[model samples]
Structures are given as structure tokens and as C-alpha cells.
Target: MAFRAYGEVQQRTAGPKEIELSLFRQITEALEAVAAVETPPLEAWADALYRNQQLWTIVATDLVNPDNTLPEETKRNLVSLSQFVRQCSNRVLAGNDGIADLIDINKSIIAGLSGIPVSTVTEEAA
Candidate 1:
């Protein structure tokens, strides 16, 4: 009975939205850590960027899955955004742009998932 209850708790904690939000938070923290250092070690930056890329890849894959319920247009938009993230991540790894935009993108997605208006959240963040 105790084990079953624990499993139920785990299921509740690992719902789709919770999982996505957690991933976003992790990416945000990793990006912030990289940004906090004037010259972050290549390994640390690479690890964080790779994780972010992996998360987006998974999101893209899920968006295209037949089981996914998102509208066709929404899936296309998300897939496009994921591709952009992949491109930007490569540039960031190559020392081109900063990670602020990537962080902002993840934050915006999280806000959308949480049912918060993006404009309001952006204003508050600013």
C-alpha cells in the first residue's frame, strides 16, 4: 500500500507539464550559471548547452508524434522554434551569441504552459 501510494505521488509529480517546467528550470539555471562567469569553462558551457538542445529535440519529437494532441499549426511552430534553438545553440557553442535569448525563450514557453500571459510575464521580468 505504501509503495503504491509512493508510485501515485511520483506519477503526480511527473505529469507532462511538470516535467516540461522542470526541464525549463534546469535549462534556465544552467544558462544562468554559464552567464554568471566572465569566462565559463568550455566543458560546463557545453554540458549545459547540450542539455538544452537535447530537451528541445525531445520536445520536437513529441510534437510530431501521432499521439500528441497539439494542433497541426502549433506543432509546426514548435518544431520550427526547436530548429532555431538548435541553430542558436551551435552558435553559442562556437562563441557567437550570448545565452540570454535562449533563456528568455525557455521562460516564455514556461509562461505559456503555466497559463500566464507572455507580455505580462515579460514586463514583470524586465
Candidate 2:
């Protein structure tokens, strides 16, 4: 299909950063969409959560890899953030309304990936 062809082209052309940003944007949107509905279907919520967790797991793995180029402090922060995401995801899965934090965290990472300063993102949100 044309759509599949386009996706393949995009995948080949996108740089690592762009690919990461796109993925975060997609997963974040999925979570936000499910959160917006009252009494969202459990299956839908779980699917979104699983995607998010998988994304974070990949990120955490890369952060710990010896070849990762990020500074130590940045890696530490990301690992901690990943841990928090995992805990929050567990709470959400247990019938708690704790998805907002996950969404916000993803938005922050997206902003960073998009080259927006952290202060600017927080100011705009506030």
C-alpha cells in the first residue's frame, strides 16, 4: 500500500533523534487519547501502557549501554525517570488514575528531543 511505502521511506530517512521523537510523540498521544475517555476499555489502556513501557525499556537499555554518548548525569536521570515510569505504569494497571504523570513526562522528553529548552516547555505548560 502507499501508506506502507511512505512509512518505509520515512523510516529509512529519519535520523535517530527524529525517530525517537516520533516514537515518543506517538506513544504519548496514544496514552493521552486513552486517558481522555471516561472508563476507557481495559484492553486499549493496557496496549498503550505496554507500548510506553516497552519504549522506556529500550531507552533504559540504551542508556546503560557502554556505547551511549550521553553524559553520565543525563543517563542517570533517564534511568531514574524510566524507573518512575515503570512504577507509575504498574499503578495505572492496578486501577489507579496515575497516567497524567506518564503523559507529562513523555511530553517533556518530546520537547527535549524537539530542541525546546526545558524552561520554555515548563513555562508554556504553566
Best by TM-score: 2
Tens-digit per-residue lDDT, 3-45, candidate 1: 9998688768798888788788878789879988999998988
For model 1, state the Cα shift of residue 65 in Å.
0.4
Estimate candidate 2's RMSD in Å: 1.8
lDDT of each candidate versus the true structure: 0.87, 0.91
- Tens digits of per-residue lDDT, candidate 2, 81-115, equal 99999999998888675698898899899888988
Off by more than 4 A, model 2? 118-126
Highest lDDT: which candidate?
2
lDDT, residue 22, candidate 2: 94
Candidate 2 global CA lDDT score: 0.91
- Alpha carbon RMSD to native, model 1: 3.8
